[model samples]
Target: MKTQDIFVLGLTTFALFLGAGNLIFPPAMGLDAGTSLTSAMAGFLITAVGLPAFTIIVLGRIGNTNNLTKALPKWLGTTFWVLLFTAIGPAFGMPRAVTVAYEMGIQPFFTNDHLVAFSIIFSAVTLFLAFKPGNLVTYIGKIMTPALIILLCGLGLAAFLSPLGTPAAPSGDYQVGAVTSGLIQGYMTMDAIAAVGFGWVIIHAIKAKGVTTQQGIASTSIKVALIYAALMASCYIVMGYVGATSTSIAEHGVNGSVILTRYVAGEFGHYGQWLLAAIILMACLTTTVGLTNACAEYYQDTFKASFGFTATVIVVLTGVIANFGLNDILKVSLPAILVLCPVAIALVLASLAASTFTVSRLTHSAVLITATLFGTIDAINILGKMPKDLGDFFSDTLPLYNAHAGWLLPSLFMLITTAMIGRTASAEKKFGRVDYRLKTANND
Candidate 1:
């Protein structure tokens, strides 16, 4: 595609990936990172922007959505995709999107009844926009995304010009390993998992633009990745800086959202609240539309269900779940996100390198299984208590457990070991066949 085409595609991709957490997390990181803003944002960008961009490239190579499932064993693939869709769609993602819109956009001005009413209206609009898959890029990229960016730019500029204060002392997790904490926090965004869901949306959009063939897809994906990385990294840096300098509000605010709301109100006076609300709603709505469409497409393809049926199911289920509100949804969904993120990251990285390495089915299975097990333990540790001794043992023995990257080493070792074994087996089989052919020729 041309420059304009790639630019629009980038806009669409950016809209799809930026959910409530993307909006909320960075500033909080900045608040904690304080003086370490540069290192922390750099680290955050790796997992948050870099990993997701890489996942998009991997999906482009595979060409279409179902091919992601081909990376693992058949049943496992199906199960993973199903669970993934749930995690990023109705169960946690969609409802969270709805709540973010309501909380940030509407809550201060309205009552609980009004929030519920707005959610229904929000779900209806999402379902309406979701029905026409081809229009997703046009709706989000051409229309909603521009408005969102303009709003963010205004807010970012205002914050940048008026200094909040010098960044306070590094606090909590940022005090020790700010970069590592930022890395893990970036991982927690779970955008890689969302990318898996959003990949097909991107491919379809590219196809709609008349770009076919693996080479074209790969090229376009590269362009999209560059745009996504640049755009997201810039936003994160600004937001993190804003958070770092928010020492005055830091006493009153515990999270990025709180800090942002206060800053906007302070900066723009009465109008800031309305501007912030609009920005939050736009951010949440775009993500909702993208996710609903992606999940609907997946279900239609896999279960042989109609698109209308699937989309309706997703929207309705999501609407009902949203009533549980944001905190509860996060509580239930955080564990799943923690466990699946490592698995998703591992899958994308392994698949991208599969052509260069002697990657076996065993390698896929072993690495995923190992990562899942460790990730589950990590997830459980988040919600409730693990045995003190066991937790201590793992935290001390594992290389990066304290960094929330305990799964990395185990997954890497399994991938290498299984690949080597598979390569050796293939070599031995080839030699045996050659020897048998020689023996047959001698007898002749």
Candidate 2:
């Protein structure tokens, strides 16, 4: 609860969420987005910085996290977590971590068939880490992140000194819809969903310090969570900008991951590339471990009856599927991330809404269910395996899906409707009129 404790714990929490996206995705986006990259970066920051930060605060305030979506109606809540966690793990999260590692780490050594090797090794290690997650917080959060940071700092500094190339023509690439692209890349960060995943770990870390009082526990948790959010937010913006300015190096026709690695190598040479590779791999390892651990924890929690038995199964299954290849994981996960991301955004907004109803179980659940239905439909469409009739029905009947933004309006509508209901309920219960009492803290 003390300010100093907040500092240390905040660093630990931030380190967990600062995965591959926090380190590499933004910079790649910035390189591609170019001048318009800033706007896109801004959009990226909304979900990346804003949502994740809000999640920490919400979890801290509510002091309860059965499941991020489990707060919703029964079937819907289960659906939400399954979709979110699955998308992040086997489909996307773990895959992305493997990707960043290959791009940054193993590629230098075994660039040929690197994707194949990267997919296998990355998944294998993450499975190994999660299979025995004992002291993972200490092993990963304490040890790995520091090394990851050193590597990133070196790469970041190298890029700063020599520069890679001028940023791409952002005005053209990002012009069509800079905001949307940035927002989409922001989803790549997965900070908001991570909040739910990391919330309990943080709580336990704090609770271990023996702060037992309810009020005291929340106060301390918020201070640290907020700080962690800020640290992560800074990283997102920097990487995005780095990506934005990488147009000159495009001639190499490099893969997105190669852009930064090449940039580092160009500036620092062979030894620098080796260091960069190590850092990139380590950074990704930290993230990969976090994702597997989060998914495993939830699976174990959901199947408490099986406990160790079930956790082992979940880890093994994901790792094996991962061996199918990194590209496979990315291809499958794209739809899931695109589908669930909007609903995730809606949850963050509603969770942080000033109104008690928006913040309450009743309203949050109602809104989440509506969004989940739309998101599921949207996801089905993207992944391209939907039942013919169902897909046609949602598209024909739903005005929004035609634009590929089905979840947006529905989520907003739910929030407004639920807020109105909450307002009415609040007045009836004598919880007072909206007096505009506010809690202020800068968050993503």
Candidate 3:
């Protein structure tokens, strides 16, 4: 594809990935990282930026998510598919998108009384667009995404030209393990799952451009990913800078949205608030539409449900839950994220290296099992689902447990061991001496 076409494709991918959480998480993380902001951001970029980029490329290479899941057993794959769509759909991500759009966008313009009304209208538009998924590239990518970028760039530039204040001292886990804590925070975004959920849109967009071959898709995806990575990195840096500097002016313990709201007001005065709100509104709208469409497509494909039925289910569920607001939804979301992200990451990594490592179904299963096992422990700890003693045991036993990446080593071990076993078994079947006595007996 030409550069212009590639840019348009990149915009859709970027908009889909750069949702409410993308806006919310980085700034708060920077505040927490404080003096360790650089190190923390580096780690954050690994998963927050890295995993999502990897996911899109992997999906592009593999053709679609259905093909990607072929690495796992049938039942497990089905379960994962269902869980992934739900987690990123109305159950969690879509609601966050709705709430964030309201809290950051329309809420500032209106009183609390209008929240219900705003949410209904927002979800109604989202549902309408979701039902017409094919035109998303044009609606979001060509129109809203460009506007979002322009507003964000203006805000970031203004912030950089004049920072809030010097960053405060590192606090909490950041004082000791800033990078690790950042990685944990990145994992918390659960964007790896979002990438998977939203990626099909990009794949379809690419195919629409008439690039059908695997190599063609993968190469085009790289260009698209580079654009996405650059945009995300730049935005994160600017947002983190804003948050880090706000330590002096803003109260401690405020969320990113509040910090950003205050900072924009401080920077550009009344008009800045509207500008920031517009940026957030566009961001959330793009994400909400993408996720709703993805959810509808998933259900329609998997269960043969009508697109309108699935879209209704998604929009209605999201609308109802969004009224609960961001914090309450986050309380439910974080644990599920902790459980799902590791498995998704492991699957992506294993698939990427499948040819080189001789990764088999067994390998994928073992890795996912190990990841899910530790991931559950992490989730349980987060939710306080297990006894203190059990949580303590898990934390103490696992390396990098405190980093929220304790699942990494065990999953890697399982992947390697299973791959070796699979390779050896394949070798035996292919090259080992035949059982001549059994062959002769069968002939007799």
TM-score versus the correct structure, for each prediction: 0.95, 0.78, 0.92
Model 3 TM-score (2 dp): 0.92
Q: List the residue pairs that clash in candidate 2.
A: 26-239, 26-240, 27-239, 27-243, 30-243, 30-244, 31-243, 31-244, 88-93, 167-245
Native-to-model Cα distance after best TM-score fit, residue 160 in candidate 2, in Å: 2.2
- Model 2 lDDT per residue over 375-401, tens place: 777777766777888878887888767
By lDDT rank, best first, the candidates go: 1, 3, 2
| lDDT of model 3 at position 409 | 91
Q: Which lDDT values do the candidates have, in the order given?
A: 0.84, 0.66, 0.82
TM-score of 2: 0.78
Error of 1 at 274 (Å): 1.1
Q: How high is the lDDT of residue 188 in model 2? A: 49
Assess candidate 2 and give its lDDT.
0.66
Top model number, lDDT: 1
The order of the candidates by TM-score, greatest first, is 1, 3, 2
